[model samples]
Target: MEKILTGTVVLDLTRFFSGPQATLFLAGLGAEVIKIDDPATGDPTTFSPPFAGPEGVSFHRKTQADMGIAYLKRARGKKSVGLNLKAPEGRAAFMKLVRSADVVIDNFSAGVADRLGIGYETLREANPGIVHCSLTGYGSTGPERNLKAYDLMVQAAVGMMSVTGQPDAPPAKAGSPLSDAIAGTFAATGILAALLHRNRTGEGQSVDVSMADCLFALMFDEPFDCYRSLGLPLRQGNRIMRFSPFNAYRTRDGWVVAGAATQDDWNALLRAMGREDLAENPQINSLSWRLANNATVDSLMSSWTEPLESAEVLRRLNEVKVPCSPVREIGEVMEWAQLKDRDMMMPLWNPLAQATVEAKGPGFPIKFSASKAAYDTPAPLPGQHSREVLMNLGGFSAHDVDAMARRGIISAP
Candidate 1:
């Protein structure tokens, strides 16, 4: 099937999670994503721990020359090009590629792109309709723009940590890199919007994505409104302020999550629990009343769930149409048949391991009937496609390529 973005070219200059993830989505949609990395060390995540192959850390680092899982997971379906943008020749070569490309993306500190001369203005000069997207810790013009931030830092800075975990415990970070991942997805949407604009008016613009801003959006409406209106952060772990009976309760065998967002759902839950009488209770009838007696409501729900196994609890709740599910581990999610049916768990060959690896993909997240969204290739090693890219895209001769490699302007692996 013809992919959605077959004709588009994306110059990916992102190192870590956010930018790379954005480009990964582009690549999955069939954009030709050329990942530019530093020739000396490449993406630092190449050396990140927890090796998947049999030989372990040393082999992952020195021998197999395979990407760490961190890089591999996010960087799949992109070509690799190593270039030293600080060098004059490298910058000129990058500009040449920019001219032929449709989009350029990066996740660097604010001002870093301009300092490196790869800012939107400079690239726009090379390709008038080029879409330039940048993902930063804070926005370009903010007071904290110049300050450094990673996923954890942004989470803390954005008050995410304050509202996470048990109220008694110290502030906690989300288990995943939520800020980076969401920002990357947002950056991709911005780039797509810019591409649409280019299609309409032949004008490209810069996409400025702030991780802090993205995290705030994920904070959801209730907490956001609470903070704004009540002037305090709510840290009731897993207990949503606006909803009743919305929590993960411990069942006999495991945990199950159940939520009653509407009066109907609450009545259904009560019906499932054989406690319909409680539905009309004076102190816990409406959402406001239930929230006011949250402790009692939770205890009441726990009383029903605590004696039953999670599967049984989930089955009874689901039978009554009360939204519920048993808590699943990562392993279970990876092996889920439903996700497999959706093609979310993709199998790709691991050349180094001489085996097929089941790598999870977003499965086009958005389904389109005419154009298929698919992962075309695995992530490349640093500079793996440098020679071919230079020859085809940059219009460099064999001699020019060799000279650039010798001068440390680019790497050819």
Candidate 2:
């Protein structure tokens, strides 16, 4: 069966999580993603690590070998090529690849690509049908476009930090790189849309994805309504800003998040807790009333949950058709049967670590009857496929590849 993106070739000039992650998704859909990196440092993510390899040996290993687990998780199904984009010869070689590619992805600062002579306008002249995706911290025209940013910085700047954590505590960033990942997802979606449009019109366009913009957009309905109608929104912690009984609560064993956002669910929850009287009580009956008397409802629920373990509480809630989940730590999530059954988790063998590691794979969102997506390979070491990509994709002779390496324009693992 033909894969979704089988014949597509993507020249990936993206380095960090956002760009690389977008390419990774394309690769999973069966595009041939050729990731180009600077010969000197490669992706910065290669150096950011809490190494998971051998006890002491892991530290001494090169950045390529010590790429943090997150990179490994995101970089599956892609090939790496090292090149110095600053060098004219290397830039020419990149353009050669771009000329033949269906798409090009990059996350350079606003005008860096244009300055480097490989911007969308330049590449489109070579391949008019090429889909160009430019990802940035802000955007091409924004005042902050040139400012360097990572996930954490964007999270703080985009009001995600303002809404996270407890109300009494300092604003906290999300545990994951939510901004970067979301931006990557948006970029990928834009690329896919551009490809669809190109199929009909035979014209490709530039796609601009902004990390800060995506982060702000992620809040969707709530933030816009709050700003337009109510003015500034205050931090609500785990509690729902608009609905009551939709927050994490303490149970006997651990934490459990339960939501009774609907009146029927609230009635069922109260019935399950043997407090039907409270369920029908006028003070706590309506959604508005529940919000107004949240303290009383929370207190009563907390008292009822105090004697029950998190798992038991969750199970009872589930039985009553209430939205509830026991708070699962990473280890517990790794062992979860539901995740395993749905293939949301994948196990890969790490040759360097000399052990098997389980990591979360792409969520089960796009299901196909014929061409299903999957993890075909693990992340490559820095410059691991440098020679292969150059020789195979660029059609470079072995002697030419060696000469380029000698000139410091390319590197090999």
Candidate 3:
């Protein structure tokens, strides 16, 4: 079947992580996503890199620039249009693109789109049913709305760092830019919902997503007040909330994480560890007692696991249906059999690298029984599709695109 969003058009004005990541999901679903970059500088990410190799990640250029690894990952399956929105002619061209677009997405500072004259209201004037989504660091109306933000900054602001890492250690950000990723997913969800609404009512609305807000929402998934009431420290590293025996354990070879999600699994895990006698102990079986005495549970689990090889520990747990697995390193995960079997390993060609590297991105995690997802195209050069998109979708003539290129309003190569 054709891709679900095959007929959709998106004018993408996002940069860096959060905004681009949201549009990436749309592109995978087969939207004709046109990424608008500044004709001269292009998206800032293009210049920011470790390239697929010291073509070290200003990371954008083909002859003089090495495309940043970030751009290589996030910009796949999308078109690029290098059109300046600062000039009058450029704004006119943008309006023309808007007329043909079903969605407009930007991840700029609160007033940036307004300063560029392509804010939601302006775009709505051009196309009444256009779904405009603005993804920002602190959202549009807060006191911190105009504050400069990055993924790390948002992580700190949202109090995520407070609960991350060991209580005694300096708070650490997750290995991934989680705030950016989560916000992107939320933004995409809002856009999809708005599109559904538009399909029925023929009226468009705006989606406002804040990086800090999204992360904050996730942090509250557990009851902080309740944990505090139980005299539990908010940050216990891997010691999860209200859950005992749900942490990483040291093994002879490496670390293994085993967790019991229910009483049946808890009993199974006890039997697997040759400690079935503890199952009859009332305090050990009480959920509150276990949570309060998590240290005792960990000490017990570790006593068994530490002397065993990680594989043996995992095998014993698996035999009894007690969920467990060895901790995998980054390289191990990259070569993991399961992910590869699901077609998550992808080959990305970097022209500047002059080589095809089997990079691990451009893979979507979702499966559709009917429709499809796609991730085959590489990121475009600055304005690579300027002439094509403007002429074909924006209804501009080749001569008009050429004139705009000459006037420094757009790039047409």
Candidate 4:
């Protein structure tokens, strides 16, 4: 079967986690994504590292190796081009790419793209069928548009921080960059929607996505209910407000997570623990009563679990059809068979380090019957394809590319 986006060309001007991740999703669906990066520094992520290179150095062999891991995962089936947008020649070259592209994505500060003359209006004027996507901190027009943001900032702004961690403790940021990931997913959805719309109308549209907006939107059901009916939802650690005996419990070896939201699940959990007396108790029969007496129920459950090993407890819980899992750390999860079987983790050879490294793979949610979304290429070395992409795709001659390179309009490292 034909690939979903086999003939689509995407001019990706996005950088960092949010924008790159969004375009990566599109690329996985078979779009020809040409990622444009600064000829000088490239993406800021290239500089931030706990890499295998020399200490206190930038772009060391180790840093490049780690960056390659991310690039390998995110830029599979995509091309990388280096250009200086601040320069006129680079801008002209970008316009050339835009004219032939189906989509253009950017994750710059609110008006940065417009200043560079690559905004949706400018690009659409050049190619009316171009699907332009802008991922920003707060969106293009808003009181907070100019405000800078990052994953942590969005987490704090969107009340995720407030709702995380223990109730009596200081609010803690999430372990992962949830805001950026969520924004990227939202941007991908928006771009896909725009692509569908363009197929019908033959007119491209601009999709404006804000990390803050996405985060707030994700909190809808609970936060809205809290604001409209109850007061702000109190921070409840681990346990769900409506469910009892549905939290992490300490086991002999480590922690295990188990939840029984429904009556049947509760019964199964009680049966798993061989506590038929408690299972038959009317006081703990209904969800409302169980929730009301959660402290007692939790105490009883903990009494049984505290003596068992985490693995044994999880085995017993699973055998009886209770929703339960062991608390797995990152290292343990990296070796998990389920994640590996699902292709959520992949290993790629890094030329910089001359070694193989593991990285998170593309998360394309939909499964196609014929054309599979698979990783095909590693991330480009800085400016690795600058000359090739400009000369081949942008229709520039060798002399023209050489002159531009000499003028610092493009760089190939």
Q: TM-score per candidate, in order?
A: 0.94, 0.91, 0.95, 0.92
Candidate 2 shows a clash count of 0
lDDT, residue 30, model 3: 89
Clashing pairs in 4: 53-62, 72-379
Report RMSD (Å) for each prediction in the order shown: 2.3, 2.7, 2.1, 2.8
Q: What is the C-alpha lDDT profile of model 3 across 386-412, one tens digit per residue?
A: 999999998998889888989999988
lDDT of 2: 0.80
lDDT of 2 by residue, 306-372 (tens): 8998878988888899988888998899888987777877754454565554334554346688996
Top candidate by TM-score: 3
lDDT per residue (tens digit) for residues 1-413 in model 4: 56788888888888778998888888778888888888887866543543323222234444434553355556666777889988887899999888888999999898888888888889988899989999998889889998889899889888888888877789888898988999999999999999999998897999999998898887655644554354334666887776887888999889988999888898898889898777667788778887767778889889999999988898898998899888999899988888777777666545466555544554566677889775456665667788887877789999999898898899865
Clashes of each: 0, 0, 7, 2
lDDT of 1 by residue, 1-413 (tens): 89989999999999878898898889878899999988887878755754444343333444464346666677678888999998889999999999899999988889999999989889988888999998999988867788888999999998888889876779899999999899989999899999999999999999899999998877865556455575434687887777888888999998999999998998899899999898668667788878877888999999999999888898899899998877899998887888888888765444466655434445556668888787767656678899999889999999999999998889996
User: How much is 24 displaced in model 2, in angstroms?
Assistant: 1.3
Candidate 1: regions farther than 4 A off: 56-66, 223-233, 351-354, 357-363
> Pick by lDDT: which candidate is best?
3
Model 2 superposed RMSD (Cα): 2.7
